[model samples]
Target: MQGTVDSTPVVTGHEVAAHEEHQDLRVLGLITFLASEFLMFAGFFAVFLVFRGSHVQWPPEETEVELLLPAVNTLILVSSSWVINLGTKAIKKNDLAGMRKWFGITAAMGAIFLAGQVYEYMNLGYGLKTNLFSNCFYLTTGFHGAHVFIGLVLILGVLWRSRRANHYNDITHTGPEMAEIYWHFVDVVWIVLFSLIYLLTLI
Candidate 1:
Protein backbone atom coordinates (compact mmCIF):
# COMPACT_ATOMS: atom_id res chain seq x y z
CA MET A 1 0.00 0.00 0.00
CA GLN A 2 1.33 3.45 -0.93
CA GLY A 3 1.50 6.39 1.48
CA THR A 4 -0.52 9.52 0.77
CA VAL A 5 0.82 11.71 -2.09
CA ASP A 6 1.00 15.59 -2.06
CA SER A 7 0.92 16.86 -5.67
CA THR A 8 0.42 20.58 -5.01
CA PRO A 9 3.20 23.22 -5.00
CA VAL A 10 4.23 24.95 -1.79
CA VAL A 11 2.71 28.32 -2.80
CA THR A 12 -0.84 29.13 -1.74
CA GLY A 13 -3.73 30.05 -4.05
CA HIS A 14 -4.02 33.43 -2.36
CA GLU A 15 -0.45 34.36 -3.35
CA VAL A 16 -1.09 33.80 -7.07
CA ALA A 17 -4.32 35.75 -6.93
CA ALA A 18 -2.59 38.65 -5.17
CA HIS A 19 0.11 38.86 -7.83
CA GLU A 20 -2.44 39.01 -10.65
CA GLU A 21 -4.43 41.66 -8.84
CA HIS A 22 -1.31 43.79 -8.39
CA GLN A 23 -0.53 43.64 -12.12
CA ASP A 24 -4.06 44.70 -13.01
CA LEU A 25 -3.87 47.59 -10.57
CA ARG A 26 -0.62 48.85 -12.09
CA VAL A 27 -2.07 48.81 -15.61
CA LEU A 28 -5.13 50.75 -14.50
CA GLY A 29 -2.96 53.29 -12.69
CA LEU A 30 -0.89 53.92 -15.80
CA ILE A 31 -3.99 54.47 -17.89
CA THR A 32 -5.38 56.94 -15.37
CA PHE A 33 -2.14 58.90 -15.32
CA LEU A 34 -2.09 59.14 -19.13
CA ALA A 35 -5.69 60.34 -19.14
CA SER A 36 -4.87 63.21 -16.77
CA GLU A 37 -1.98 64.26 -18.99
CA PHE A 38 -4.30 64.29 -22.00
CA LEU A 39 -6.70 66.59 -20.19
CA MET A 40 -3.95 69.06 -19.31
CA PHE A 41 -2.82 69.32 -22.92
CA ALA A 42 -6.40 69.68 -24.03
CA GLY A 43 -6.77 72.76 -21.83
CA PHE A 44 -3.73 74.32 -23.43
CA PHE A 45 -5.12 73.65 -26.90
CA ALA A 46 -8.39 75.30 -25.98
CA VAL A 47 -6.62 78.44 -24.80
CA PHE A 48 -4.64 78.55 -28.03
CA LEU A 49 -7.78 78.28 -30.09
CA VAL A 50 -9.38 81.14 -28.24
CA PHE A 51 -6.35 83.37 -28.75
CA ARG A 52 -6.08 82.38 -32.40
CA GLY A 53 -9.67 83.45 -33.01
CA SER A 54 -8.80 86.97 -31.83
CA HIS A 55 -6.24 87.40 -34.62
CA VAL A 56 -7.00 89.10 -37.98
CA GLN A 57 -6.01 85.97 -39.82
CA TRP A 58 -5.85 82.65 -38.02
CA PRO A 59 -2.04 82.93 -38.06
CA PRO A 60 -2.01 86.75 -38.64
CA GLU A 61 -2.48 88.38 -42.03
CA GLU A 62 0.62 90.61 -41.94
CA THR A 63 3.15 88.05 -40.71
CA GLU A 64 3.55 84.57 -42.20
CA VAL A 65 5.23 81.61 -40.57
CA GLU A 66 7.84 80.11 -42.88
CA LEU A 67 6.66 76.70 -43.95
CA LEU A 68 9.94 75.49 -45.46
CA LEU A 69 12.06 75.37 -42.28
CA PRO A 70 9.23 74.09 -40.11
CA ALA A 71 8.53 71.43 -42.72
CA VAL A 72 12.14 70.28 -42.58
CA ASN A 73 12.07 70.20 -38.79
CA THR A 74 8.86 68.19 -38.87
CA LEU A 75 10.55 65.62 -41.11
CA ILE A 76 13.50 65.42 -38.74
CA LEU A 77 11.23 64.84 -35.76
CA VAL A 78 9.27 62.12 -37.61
CA SER A 79 12.55 60.41 -38.53
CA SER A 80 13.69 60.55 -34.90
CA SER A 81 10.50 58.78 -33.88
CA TRP A 82 11.22 56.05 -36.42
CA VAL A 83 14.76 55.61 -35.10
CA ILE A 84 13.49 55.33 -31.53
CA ASN A 85 11.00 52.68 -32.64
CA LEU A 86 13.87 50.69 -34.11
CA GLY A 87 15.84 51.14 -30.91
CA THR A 88 12.95 49.82 -28.83
CA LYS A 89 12.66 46.77 -31.08
CA ALA A 90 16.41 46.12 -30.79
CA ILE A 91 16.27 46.36 -27.02
CA LYS A 92 13.51 43.76 -27.01
CA LYS A 93 15.70 41.44 -29.07
CA ASN A 94 18.63 41.95 -26.67
CA ASP A 95 20.65 43.63 -29.36
CA LEU A 96 22.45 46.27 -27.31
CA ALA A 97 24.62 47.42 -30.16
CA GLY A 98 21.69 47.96 -32.45
CA MET A 99 19.82 49.81 -29.74
CA ARG A 100 22.77 52.09 -29.11
CA LYS A 101 23.22 52.88 -32.81
CA TRP A 102 19.57 53.67 -33.36
CA PHE A 103 19.30 55.77 -30.24
CA GLY A 104 22.36 57.76 -31.27
CA ILE A 105 20.83 58.45 -34.68
CA THR A 106 17.65 59.56 -33.00
CA ALA A 107 19.52 61.94 -30.73
CA ALA A 108 21.29 63.46 -33.72
CA MET A 109 18.00 64.03 -35.47
CA GLY A 110 16.62 65.72 -32.36
CA ALA A 111 19.56 68.08 -32.28
CA ILE A 112 19.01 68.96 -35.93
CA PHE A 113 15.38 69.68 -35.22
CA LEU A 114 16.28 71.92 -32.31
CA ALA A 115 18.75 73.86 -34.42
CA GLY A 116 16.18 74.37 -37.11
CA GLN A 117 13.75 75.69 -34.51
CA VAL A 118 16.27 78.26 -33.38
CA TYR A 119 16.85 79.39 -36.96
CA GLU A 120 13.15 79.79 -37.54
CA TYR A 121 12.71 81.76 -34.36
CA MET A 122 15.51 84.13 -35.27
CA ASN A 123 14.17 84.73 -38.77
CA LEU A 124 10.54 85.27 -37.87
CA GLY A 125 9.83 88.92 -38.76
CA TYR A 126 8.13 89.57 -35.44
CA GLY A 127 9.29 89.05 -31.88
CA LEU A 128 7.29 87.41 -29.14
CA LYS A 129 5.73 90.74 -28.18
CA THR A 130 5.00 91.74 -31.78
CA ASN A 131 1.42 90.52 -32.04
CA LEU A 132 -0.96 87.65 -31.30
CA PHE A 133 0.50 85.51 -34.04
CA SER A 134 4.05 85.95 -32.82
CA ASN A 135 3.05 85.23 -29.26
CA CYS A 136 1.18 82.06 -30.14
CA PHE A 137 3.90 80.89 -32.51
CA TYR A 138 6.65 81.36 -29.95
CA LEU A 139 4.63 79.91 -27.09
CA THR A 140 3.62 76.77 -28.92
CA THR A 141 6.95 76.06 -30.62
CA GLY A 142 8.97 77.09 -27.58
CA PHE A 143 7.09 74.66 -25.38
CA HIS A 144 7.67 71.87 -27.87
CA GLY A 145 11.36 72.81 -28.16
CA ALA A 146 11.73 72.54 -24.42
CA HIS A 147 10.23 69.05 -24.56
CA VAL A 148 12.71 68.06 -27.26
CA PHE A 149 15.55 69.25 -25.07
CA ILE A 150 14.23 67.16 -22.20
CA GLY A 151 13.81 64.11 -24.44
CA LEU A 152 17.38 64.49 -25.64
CA VAL A 153 18.62 64.45 -22.08
CA LEU A 154 16.56 61.37 -21.35
CA ILE A 155 17.89 59.54 -24.40
CA LEU A 156 21.45 60.40 -23.46
CA GLY A 157 20.93 59.09 -19.95
CA VAL A 158 19.52 55.85 -21.33
CA LEU A 159 22.50 55.50 -23.64
CA TRP A 160 24.92 55.96 -20.78
CA ARG A 161 23.17 53.45 -18.55
CA SER A 162 22.76 50.87 -21.29
CA ARG A 163 26.54 50.73 -21.60
CA ARG A 164 26.91 49.37 -18.05
CA ALA A 165 23.71 47.53 -17.23
CA ASN A 166 21.77 44.93 -19.17
CA HIS A 167 18.59 46.21 -17.60
CA TYR A 168 16.64 46.34 -20.86
CA ASN A 169 15.31 43.07 -22.19
CA ASP A 170 12.22 41.54 -23.78
CA ILE A 171 10.34 41.59 -20.49
CA THR A 172 11.86 44.66 -18.83
CA HIS A 173 12.44 47.79 -20.89
CA THR A 174 10.00 50.17 -19.27
CA GLY A 175 12.42 53.10 -19.33
CA PRO A 176 12.74 53.04 -23.10
CA GLU A 177 9.05 52.38 -23.49
CA MET A 178 8.10 55.42 -21.43
CA ALA A 179 10.61 57.57 -23.26
CA GLU A 180 9.19 56.50 -26.60
CA ILE A 181 5.71 57.31 -25.39
CA TYR A 182 6.75 60.81 -24.40
CA TRP A 183 8.61 61.25 -27.68
CA HIS A 184 5.58 60.25 -29.68
CA PHE A 185 3.44 62.65 -27.69
CA VAL A 186 5.85 65.43 -28.56
CA ASP A 187 5.77 64.49 -32.23
CA VAL A 188 1.99 64.53 -32.31
CA VAL A 189 1.87 67.97 -30.70
CA TRP A 190 4.20 69.33 -33.37
CA ILE A 191 2.13 67.84 -36.15
CA VAL A 192 -0.92 69.61 -34.83
CA LEU A 193 0.99 72.87 -34.46
CA PHE A 194 2.36 72.61 -37.99
CA SER A 195 -1.03 72.05 -39.48
CA LEU A 196 -2.74 74.82 -37.56
CA ILE A 197 0.02 77.43 -37.60
CA TYR A 198 1.57 76.80 -41.01
CA LEU A 199 -0.57 74.85 -43.44
CA LEU A 200 -3.95 76.19 -42.40
CA THR A 201 -2.67 79.75 -42.55
CA LEU A 202 -2.23 79.39 -46.32
CA ILE A 203 -5.89 78.60 -46.74
Candidate 2:
Protein backbone atom coordinates (compact mmCIF):
# COMPACT_ATOMS: atom_id res chain seq x y z
CA MET A 1 0.00 0.00 0.00
CA GLN A 2 1.26 3.50 -0.87
CA GLY A 3 1.06 6.26 1.73
CA THR A 4 -0.35 9.67 0.76
CA VAL A 5 1.49 12.91 1.50
CA ASP A 6 -0.43 15.74 3.17
CA SER A 7 0.07 19.13 1.49
CA THR A 8 -2.33 22.03 1.76
CA PRO A 9 -2.22 25.09 -0.50
CA VAL A 10 -1.01 28.35 1.08
CA VAL A 11 -2.57 31.69 0.22
CA THR A 12 -0.12 34.57 0.19
CA GLY A 13 -1.13 38.26 0.18
CA HIS A 14 0.54 38.53 -3.22
CA GLU A 15 -2.62 37.27 -4.88
CA VAL A 16 -2.87 40.07 -7.41
CA ALA A 17 -6.64 40.25 -7.68
CA ALA A 18 -7.22 40.27 -3.95
CA HIS A 19 -4.46 42.80 -3.35
CA GLU A 20 -5.84 45.17 -5.97
CA GLU A 21 -9.33 44.89 -4.56
CA HIS A 22 -8.08 45.71 -1.06
CA GLN A 23 -6.11 48.66 -2.38
CA ASP A 24 -9.13 50.08 -4.16
CA LEU A 25 -11.29 49.71 -1.10
CA ARG A 26 -8.70 51.38 1.12
CA VAL A 27 -8.29 54.34 -1.21
CA LEU A 28 -12.02 54.84 -1.46
CA GLY A 29 -12.40 54.67 2.30
CA LEU A 30 -9.71 57.26 2.87
CA ILE A 31 -11.26 59.65 0.37
CA THR A 32 -14.64 59.33 2.02
CA PHE A 33 -13.16 60.08 5.44
CA LEU A 34 -11.33 63.12 4.15
CA ALA A 35 -14.50 64.39 2.49
CA SER A 36 -16.42 64.25 5.76
CA GLU A 37 -13.58 66.16 7.42
CA PHE A 38 -13.77 68.81 4.70
CA LEU A 39 -17.45 69.37 5.43
CA MET A 40 -16.75 69.83 9.14
CA PHE A 41 -14.11 72.41 8.45
CA ALA A 42 -16.40 74.14 5.99
CA GLY A 43 -18.99 74.53 8.69
CA PHE A 44 -16.41 76.12 10.99
CA PHE A 45 -15.29 78.46 8.24
CA ALA A 46 -18.87 79.49 7.61
CA VAL A 47 -19.39 80.24 11.27
CA PHE A 48 -16.25 82.36 11.34
CA LEU A 49 -17.34 84.34 8.32
CA VAL A 50 -20.79 84.94 9.73
CA PHE A 51 -19.42 86.22 13.03
CA ARG A 52 -16.82 88.36 11.33
CA GLY A 53 -19.44 89.95 9.10
CA SER A 54 -21.79 90.69 11.98
CA HIS A 55 -19.24 92.31 14.30
CA VAL A 56 -18.04 95.80 13.43
CA GLN A 57 -14.90 95.40 15.55
CA TRP A 58 -13.69 91.85 14.97
CA PRO A 59 -10.72 91.61 17.30
CA PRO A 60 -11.80 94.67 19.27
CA GLU A 61 -9.48 97.39 20.59
CA GLU A 62 -8.17 95.38 23.55
CA THR A 63 -7.39 92.15 21.69
CA GLU A 64 -4.30 91.84 19.52
CA VAL A 65 -2.95 88.84 17.57
CA GLU A 66 0.72 89.06 16.68
CA LEU A 67 1.53 87.54 13.32
CA LEU A 68 5.27 86.86 13.56
CA LEU A 69 5.42 83.70 15.69
CA PRO A 70 2.40 82.09 14.08
CA ALA A 71 3.82 82.84 10.66
CA VAL A 72 7.10 81.22 11.61
CA ASN A 73 5.26 78.17 12.87
CA THR A 74 3.31 77.98 9.63
CA LEU A 75 6.55 77.98 7.67
CA ILE A 76 7.87 75.17 9.82
CA LEU A 77 4.74 73.09 9.38
CA VAL A 78 4.70 73.61 5.62
CA SER A 79 8.39 72.85 5.31
CA SER A 80 7.84 69.53 7.06
CA SER A 81 5.50 68.47 4.30
CA TRP A 82 8.20 69.13 1.75
CA VAL A 83 10.81 67.34 3.83
CA ILE A 84 8.77 64.14 4.22
CA ASN A 85 8.17 63.96 0.51
CA LEU A 86 11.91 63.97 0.08
CA GLY A 87 11.97 60.91 2.30
CA THR A 88 9.42 59.17 0.11
CA LYS A 89 11.36 60.12 -2.97
CA ALA A 90 14.57 58.91 -1.37
CA ILE A 91 13.17 55.47 -0.75
CA LYS A 92 12.07 55.42 -4.38
CA LYS A 93 15.72 55.86 -5.28
CA ASN A 94 16.68 53.04 -2.85
CA ASP A 95 18.33 55.50 -0.46
CA LEU A 96 17.19 54.20 2.90
CA ALA A 97 19.59 56.32 4.92
CA GLY A 98 18.43 59.49 3.19
CA MET A 99 14.82 58.52 3.70
CA ARG A 100 15.32 57.98 7.41
CA LYS A 101 17.10 61.30 7.84
CA TRP A 102 14.42 63.25 6.06
CA PHE A 103 11.61 61.48 7.93
CA GLY A 104 13.28 62.16 11.29
CA ILE A 105 13.60 65.84 10.39
CA THR A 106 9.99 65.92 9.31
CA ALA A 107 8.90 64.52 12.66
CA ALA A 108 11.05 67.07 14.46
CA MET A 109 9.57 69.91 12.47
CA GLY A 110 6.09 68.73 13.41
CA ALA A 111 7.11 68.76 17.07
CA ILE A 112 8.44 72.29 16.74
CA PHE A 113 5.17 73.39 15.19
CA LEU A 114 3.14 71.98 18.07
CA ALA A 115 5.49 73.67 20.53
CA GLY A 116 4.95 76.97 18.77
CA GLN A 117 1.19 76.49 18.99
CA VAL A 118 1.34 75.90 22.75
CA TYR A 119 3.55 78.96 23.17
CA GLU A 120 1.17 81.11 21.17
CA TYR A 121 -1.80 79.95 23.18
CA MET A 122 -0.07 80.68 26.50
CA ASN A 123 0.93 84.20 25.47
CA LEU A 124 -2.20 85.19 23.54
CA GLY A 125 -3.40 87.27 26.54
CA TYR A 126 -6.95 86.15 25.92
CA GLY A 127 -9.24 83.35 26.98
CA LEU A 128 -11.58 81.15 24.96
CA LYS A 129 -14.42 83.36 26.20
CA THR A 130 -12.64 86.55 25.15
CA ASN A 131 -14.72 87.27 22.07
CA LEU A 132 -15.96 85.77 18.84
CA PHE A 133 -12.64 86.13 17.04
CA SER A 134 -10.66 84.84 19.98
CA ASN A 135 -13.06 82.00 20.53
CA CYS A 136 -12.96 80.95 16.89
CA PHE A 137 -9.22 81.41 16.69
CA TYR A 138 -8.54 79.19 19.69
CA LEU A 139 -11.05 76.56 18.74
CA THR A 140 -10.04 76.25 15.08
CA THR A 141 -6.31 76.43 15.73
CA GLY A 142 -6.48 74.09 18.70
CA PHE A 143 -8.15 71.50 16.53
CA HIS A 144 -5.58 71.99 13.80
CA GLY A 145 -2.77 71.68 16.32
CA ALA A 146 -4.20 68.40 17.56
CA HIS A 147 -4.26 67.09 13.99
CA VAL A 148 -0.66 68.15 13.57
CA PHE A 149 0.21 66.12 16.65
CA ILE A 150 -1.54 63.11 15.17
CA GLY A 151 0.34 63.54 11.92
CA LEU A 152 3.59 63.59 13.85
CA VAL A 153 2.62 60.31 15.47
CA LEU A 154 1.93 58.84 12.07
CA ILE A 155 5.28 60.03 10.74
CA LEU A 156 7.04 58.47 13.71
CA GLY A 157 5.25 55.21 13.05
CA VAL A 158 6.47 55.22 9.47
CA LEU A 159 9.96 55.94 10.67
CA TRP A 160 9.76 52.98 13.04
CA ARG A 161 8.51 50.66 10.32
CA SER A 162 11.26 51.75 7.97
CA ARG A 163 13.70 50.10 10.39
CA ARG A 164 12.31 46.62 9.86
CA ALA A 165 14.45 44.19 7.87
CA ASN A 166 13.77 44.49 4.13
CA HIS A 167 10.36 45.99 4.84
CA TYR A 168 10.06 49.04 2.53
CA ASN A 169 11.40 50.29 -0.75
CA ASP A 170 10.39 52.99 -3.19
CA ILE A 171 7.74 50.91 -4.94
CA THR A 172 6.75 48.84 -1.92
CA HIS A 173 5.57 51.47 0.54
CA THR A 174 1.98 52.65 0.97
CA GLY A 175 1.80 53.36 4.67
CA PRO A 176 4.22 56.25 4.37
CA GLU A 177 2.37 57.55 1.36
CA MET A 178 -0.87 57.61 3.32
CA ALA A 179 0.84 59.39 6.20
CA GLU A 180 2.30 61.89 3.74
CA ILE A 181 -1.12 62.59 2.29
CA TYR A 182 -2.47 63.18 5.79
CA TRP A 183 0.39 65.54 6.65
CA HIS A 184 -0.10 67.45 3.45
CA PHE A 185 -3.79 67.73 4.22
CA VAL A 186 -2.93 69.11 7.64
CA ASP A 187 -0.57 71.62 6.05
CA VAL A 188 -3.20 72.79 3.60
CA VAL A 189 -5.75 73.22 6.36
CA TRP A 190 -3.25 75.27 8.36
CA ILE A 191 -2.62 77.47 5.35
CA VAL A 192 -6.31 78.21 5.09
CA LEU A 193 -6.56 78.77 8.82
CA PHE A 194 -3.57 81.10 8.76
CA SER A 195 -5.15 83.13 6.01
CA LEU A 196 -8.45 83.42 7.83
CA ILE A 197 -7.20 83.86 11.40
CA TYR A 198 -3.72 85.40 11.24
CA LEU A 199 -3.45 87.22 7.93
CA LEU A 200 -6.99 88.56 8.14
CA THR A 201 -6.19 90.00 11.53
CA LEU A 202 -3.13 91.80 10.16
CA ILE A 203 -5.32 93.42 7.53
Candidate 3:
Protein backbone atom coordinates (compact mmCIF):
# COMPACT_ATOMS: atom_id res chain seq x y z
CA MET A 1 0.00 0.00 0.00
CA GLN A 2 1.26 3.46 -0.96
CA GLY A 3 0.47 6.43 1.30
CA THR A 4 0.49 10.14 0.40
CA VAL A 5 1.46 12.78 2.99
CA ASP A 6 1.26 16.60 3.19
CA SER A 7 4.61 18.30 3.97
CA THR A 8 3.31 21.79 4.79
CA PRO A 9 4.09 23.11 8.23
CA VAL A 10 1.34 24.62 10.41
CA VAL A 11 1.87 27.92 12.23
CA THR A 12 0.73 27.96 15.84
CA GLY A 13 -1.33 30.86 17.30
CA HIS A 14 1.46 31.75 19.74
CA GLU A 15 3.95 32.06 16.88
CA VAL A 16 1.59 34.41 15.04
CA ALA A 17 1.23 36.63 18.12
CA ALA A 18 4.99 36.70 18.62
CA HIS A 19 5.57 37.75 15.04
CA GLU A 20 2.98 40.52 15.31
CA GLU A 21 4.56 41.78 18.53
CA HIS A 22 7.99 41.95 16.89
CA GLN A 23 6.57 43.85 13.96
CA ASP A 24 4.90 46.34 16.29
CA LEU A 25 8.17 47.01 18.10
CA ARG A 26 10.04 47.68 14.87
CA VAL A 27 7.29 50.04 13.64
CA LEU A 28 7.25 51.93 16.94
CA GLY A 29 11.00 52.47 16.77
CA LEU A 30 10.83 53.68 13.19
CA ILE A 31 8.06 56.19 14.09
CA THR A 32 10.16 57.61 16.90
CA PHE A 33 13.20 58.08 14.67
CA LEU A 34 11.13 59.70 11.91
CA ALA A 35 9.47 62.07 14.40
CA SER A 36 12.88 63.39 15.43
CA GLU A 37 13.94 63.86 11.81
CA PHE A 38 10.68 65.74 11.10
CA LEU A 39 11.27 68.06 14.03
CA MET A 40 14.78 68.87 12.78
CA PHE A 41 13.35 69.86 9.38
CA ALA A 42 10.59 71.85 11.09
CA GLY A 43 13.23 73.93 12.86
CA PHE A 44 14.94 74.68 9.53
CA PHE A 45 11.60 75.65 8.00
CA ALA A 46 10.91 78.03 10.89
CA VAL A 47 14.27 79.70 10.47
CA PHE A 48 13.63 80.09 6.74
CA LEU A 49 10.24 81.68 7.36
CA VAL A 50 11.70 84.10 9.85
CA PHE A 51 14.60 85.12 7.59
CA ARG A 52 12.34 85.48 4.55
CA GLY A 53 9.90 87.70 6.45
CA SER A 54 12.73 90.01 7.56
CA HIS A 55 14.10 90.53 4.04
CA VAL A 56 12.48 92.99 1.58
CA GLN A 57 13.62 91.11 -1.52
CA TRP A 58 13.88 87.37 -0.82
CA PRO A 59 16.22 86.31 -3.63
CA PRO A 60 17.84 89.80 -3.86
CA GLU A 61 16.89 90.27 -7.57
CA GLU A 62 20.43 89.57 -8.89
CA THR A 63 20.35 85.85 -8.17
CA GLU A 64 18.31 83.65 -10.46
CA VAL A 65 16.89 80.26 -9.51
CA GLU A 66 16.25 78.34 -12.69
CA LEU A 67 13.21 76.06 -12.67
CA LEU A 68 14.48 73.69 -15.36
CA LEU A 69 17.13 71.61 -13.55
CA PRO A 70 15.24 71.29 -10.30
CA ALA A 71 12.08 70.42 -12.16
CA VAL A 72 13.94 67.62 -13.91
CA ASN A 73 15.46 66.49 -10.62
CA THR A 74 11.99 66.38 -9.08
CA LEU A 75 10.81 64.09 -11.85
CA ILE A 76 13.83 61.87 -11.33
CA LEU A 77 13.29 61.63 -7.57
CA VAL A 78 9.58 60.90 -7.94
CA SER A 79 10.37 58.16 -10.43
CA SER A 80 12.97 56.70 -8.05
CA SER A 81 10.38 56.53 -5.33
CA TRP A 82 8.17 54.46 -7.60
CA VAL A 83 11.13 52.24 -8.45
CA ILE A 84 11.82 51.57 -4.77
CA ASN A 85 8.17 50.68 -4.24
CA LEU A 86 8.43 48.18 -7.05
CA GLY A 87 11.49 46.71 -5.36
CA THR A 88 9.53 46.33 -2.15
CA LYS A 89 6.75 44.54 -4.01
CA ALA A 90 9.27 42.22 -5.60
CA ILE A 91 10.84 41.46 -2.20
CA LYS A 92 7.43 40.59 -0.82
CA LYS A 93 6.89 38.21 -3.66
CA ASN A 94 10.20 36.47 -2.75
CA ASP A 95 11.74 37.70 -5.95
CA LEU A 96 15.31 38.55 -4.92
CA ALA A 97 16.56 39.25 -8.45
CA GLY A 98 13.63 41.58 -9.17
CA MET A 99 14.16 43.46 -5.90
CA ARG A 100 17.88 43.92 -6.52
CA LYS A 101 17.36 45.13 -10.10
CA TRP A 102 14.64 47.63 -9.15
CA PHE A 103 16.47 48.90 -6.06
CA GLY A 104 19.72 49.27 -8.00
CA ILE A 105 17.90 51.40 -10.53
CA THR A 106 16.34 53.43 -7.72
CA ALA A 107 19.74 54.11 -6.21
CA ALA A 108 21.16 55.12 -9.57
CA MET A 109 18.32 57.59 -10.13
CA GLY A 110 18.90 59.13 -6.71
CA ALA A 111 22.61 59.45 -7.45
CA ILE A 112 21.76 61.22 -10.70
CA PHE A 113 19.45 63.61 -8.89
CA LEU A 114 22.18 64.41 -6.39
CA ALA A 115 24.64 64.97 -9.20
CA GLY A 116 22.22 67.38 -10.84
CA GLN A 117 21.94 69.33 -7.63
CA VAL A 118 25.70 69.60 -7.46
CA TYR A 119 25.83 70.83 -11.02
CA GLU A 120 23.19 73.44 -10.29
CA TYR A 121 25.17 74.65 -7.31
CA MET A 122 28.40 74.85 -9.29
CA ASN A 123 26.80 76.83 -12.11
CA LEU A 124 24.75 79.21 -9.97
CA GLY A 125 26.24 82.68 -9.44
CA TYR A 126 24.93 82.92 -5.88
CA GLY A 127 25.97 80.69 -3.02
CA LEU A 128 25.29 80.08 0.68
CA LYS A 129 26.64 83.51 1.65
CA THR A 130 24.72 85.44 -1.05
CA ASN A 131 21.58 86.24 0.97
CA LEU A 132 18.99 84.91 3.39
CA PHE A 133 17.25 83.11 0.51
CA SER A 134 20.49 81.55 -0.60
CA ASN A 135 21.31 80.41 2.91
CA CYS A 136 17.89 78.93 3.45
CA PHE A 137 17.75 77.36 0.04
CA TYR A 138 21.16 75.75 0.31
CA LEU A 139 20.72 74.61 3.88
CA THR A 140 17.28 73.08 3.35
CA THR A 141 18.09 71.45 0.03
CA GLY A 142 21.50 70.25 1.21
CA PHE A 143 19.97 68.73 4.31
CA HIS A 144 17.39 66.92 2.21
CA GLY A 145 20.14 65.75 -0.09
CA ALA A 146 21.98 64.29 2.87
CA HIS A 147 18.84 62.40 3.81
CA VAL A 148 18.62 61.04 0.29
CA PHE A 149 22.17 59.81 0.54
CA ILE A 150 21.42 58.14 3.85
CA GLY A 151 18.36 56.47 2.36
CA LEU A 152 20.47 55.23 -0.54
CA VAL A 153 22.93 53.68 1.89
CA LEU A 154 20.09 51.96 3.69
CA ILE A 155 18.70 50.55 0.46
CA LEU A 156 22.14 49.28 -0.44
CA GLY A 157 22.40 47.67 2.96
CA VAL A 158 19.05 45.96 2.41
CA LEU A 159 20.22 44.79 -0.98
CA TRP A 160 23.40 43.41 0.49
CA ARG A 161 21.59 41.73 3.35
CA SER A 162 19.00 40.26 1.03
CA ARG A 163 21.75 38.78 -1.06
CA ARG A 164 23.48 37.34 1.99
CA ALA A 165 20.46 36.02 3.83
CA ASN A 166 17.37 34.29 2.49
CA HIS A 167 15.14 35.54 5.32
CA TYR A 168 13.28 38.30 3.45
CA ASN A 169 10.08 37.18 1.80
CA ASP A 170 6.38 38.05 2.09
CA ILE A 171 6.64 36.76 5.65
CA THR A 172 9.69 38.36 7.31
CA HIS A 173 11.01 41.51 5.63
CA THR A 174 10.92 44.17 8.35
CA GLY A 175 14.40 45.56 7.65
CA PRO A 176 13.74 46.15 3.96
CA GLU A 177 10.31 47.57 4.79
CA MET A 178 11.90 50.07 7.16
CA ALA A 179 14.41 51.18 4.53
CA GLU A 180 11.67 51.62 1.93
CA ILE A 181 9.47 53.67 4.28
CA TYR A 182 12.41 55.92 5.10
CA TRP A 183 13.10 56.36 1.40
CA HIS A 184 9.43 57.33 0.97
CA PHE A 185 9.74 59.91 3.73
CA VAL A 186 12.83 61.39 2.08
CA ASP A 187 11.01 61.65 -1.26
CA VAL A 188 7.97 63.36 0.30
CA VAL A 189 10.16 65.90 2.11
CA TRP A 190 11.99 66.76 -1.13
CA ILE A 191 8.64 67.55 -2.81
CA VAL A 192 7.67 69.89 0.01
CA LEU A 193 11.10 71.52 0.11
CA PHE A 194 11.12 72.01 -3.68
CA SER A 195 7.75 73.73 -3.57
CA LEU A 196 8.83 75.99 -0.74
CA ILE A 197 12.21 77.00 -2.15
CA TYR A 198 11.38 77.28 -5.87
CA LEU A 199 7.66 77.99 -6.19
CA LEU A 200 7.02 79.96 -3.00
CA THR A 201 10.25 81.91 -3.40
CA LEU A 202 8.83 83.41 -6.60
CA ILE A 203 5.90 84.71 -4.56
Candidates' lDDT values, in order?
0.79, 0.84, 0.85
lDDT of 3 by residue, 1-203 (tens): 24767644556676775665423478668878998998899899889878778878876787768789999999999988899999989989998888889989988998999999999999888899987788888999999999999998998898788767686887777877788889888988888888877877677
Off by over 4 Å in 3: 1-24
| Top-scoring candidate (lDDT) | 3
Q: Rank the candidates by lDDT, best first.
A: 3, 2, 1
Q: What would the per-residue lDDT of candidate 1 be over residues 1-203, giving only the tens digit for each residue? A: 26868656555797775665323244345556657765765666677778777765676666678989899899999878999999999989988888889989988999999999998888877889988778777887888788789888888887888877777777767777676767777788778778877787777
Of 1 and 2, the candidate ahead on TM-score is 2
How big is the positional error of residue 9 in model 3, measured in Å on the Cα after superposition?
Answer: 27
For all candidates, the clash counts are: 0, 0, 0
In candidate 2, how many Å is residue 24 off? 5.7
Best by TM-score: 2
Judge candidate 1 at residue 99 and give its lDDT: 86
* Of candidates 3 and 2, the better by lDDT: 3
Which wins on TM-score, candidate 2 or candidate 3? Answer: 2
TM-score of 1: 0.81
- Mind giving the per-residue lDDT tens digits that candidate 2 earns over 1-203? 25876554345455754645434355456667877887887788889989988988887767778799998999899888999999889888878888889889999999999999899889988988988788898899988888889889988998899899767786676777777888988898899988987788766
